[model samples]
Target: MPIKTPSELFIHDLSDTYSAEKQMTRSLPRLARAATDPQLAQAFEDHLEETRAQVERIEEIAEALGLKLKRIKCEGMAGLVEETLSMVDQVQEGPVLDAALIGSAQKAEHYEIASYTSLILMAMKLGYAPAVPLLQATLAEEQATDKRLGAMAEASAIEQAEATS
Candidate 1:
């Protein structure tokens, strides 16, 4: 699709995020199972629920905007997930893998945060008032997830990984 209007761009971004969240729904459980740290595993599991909600919110936004969800593949997130999957296979089940998992999770969260932030700003600029709050909520959740991963890394994963090495 050629870049034409802000609305067009917004819809594209919306679809992209929707696809990303849907991808996470499948990937998160695997990540959770791969984690050796109890807290980290739980965090991934909790975020899977949040990811589902985010997917629904994006769909709601599409309905509110009178736009159908585009079937756009989020290649960026696919690449990220692939990288994480490779790490899971390469690393032994231990704190090192847990740390790598946190790093991978944080990278995905950061991508989401950036995407949602951009979408919220665009929605506001385009006067899509209804989308603003929905996107904002997801953005906040992504940020919180990132922070939780950071805390997990700082509190245990990183130190344990280093100690074992």
Candidate 2:
């Protein structure tokens, strides 16, 4: 459907985020398994649960708005997942791979942060008051996840990879 109004645009963006969350659910497990650092692996696992809740929040927003989320593919997220997996295949599994995974995960987190920021602004503008909090909560989670990944990279992944090289 062509977006004819701000409301339609909001729904379109929401659906895109829904698709991205679904894709993350599918890809995160592989990332968890591939991560050699126990803490990093556990972070992936933890985020998977958060992602599931985030999906539910989006559903709640959709139901509240009386909008059915479109069955759309978030190509942006798909590209990120594909690029991460491809990088995984090219790198040898270990600290280097862990570093790569962190980089990929951070990329995803940044993407999500931007998406959620837009979503919150759109929700507020479209008078989707209920959705603003939900979107904000997810945005916080994404930001926290990005911070955690950055800390992990600094604490170990990058350093370990550098030492190995």
Candidate 3:
């Protein structure tokens, strides 16, 4: 459907994010398995649960707003997940790979952060008061995940990778 109004645009973006969250649910397990660092592996596992909840939150918003989320593929997230998974093949399975995974995960987190931020703003502007809290909750989770990943990278992953080099 052609987006001729702000509400339509909001739905488009929301649907895109829904697709992104679904993609992550599938990709995160691989990431968790590939992570050599215990903390990193656990982080991926934890985020997988969060991503599941986030998907449900989006669905709740859709139901509350009486909008059906489009079954569109979010190409942006597809590319991000592809790149993230490819890191396993590109790098050796160790500290270097762990570091690479952090990088990849952060890229996805940043994408989600931006997407959620825009969605929140759109929700507010479109008078989607019901969606604001749900979007904000997901946004908070994404931001926290990014921060945890960054801390892990700084505290160990990057340093370990460098030590191996």
| lDDT per residue (tens digit) for residues 71-146 in model 2 | 9999999999999999889999999999999999999999999999999998888789999999999999999999
* lDDT of candidate 3 over 66-155, digit per residue (tens): 999999999999999998878898899999999999999999999999999999999998889999999999999999999999999999
CA shift at 81, candidate 1, in angstroms? 0.3
Q: Judged by lDDT relative to the true structure, which candidate is superior, 1 or 2? A: 2
Clashes of each: 0, 0, 0
What does each candidate score in C-alpha RMSD?
A: 0.7, 0.6, 0.6
**Deviation in Å, model 1, residue 7 alpha carbon:** 0.8
Question: What does the lDDT come to for candidate 2?
Answer: 0.96
Candidate 2 regions with alpha-carbon error over 4 angstroms: none
User: Which candidate ranks first by lDDT, i.e. highest?
Assistant: 2
What are the models' TM-scores?
0.98, 0.98, 0.99
What residue runs in model 1 are displaced by over 4 Å at the alpha carbon?
none
lDDT of 2 at 104: 96
Question: Local error of candidate 1 at 138, Å?
Answer: 0.7
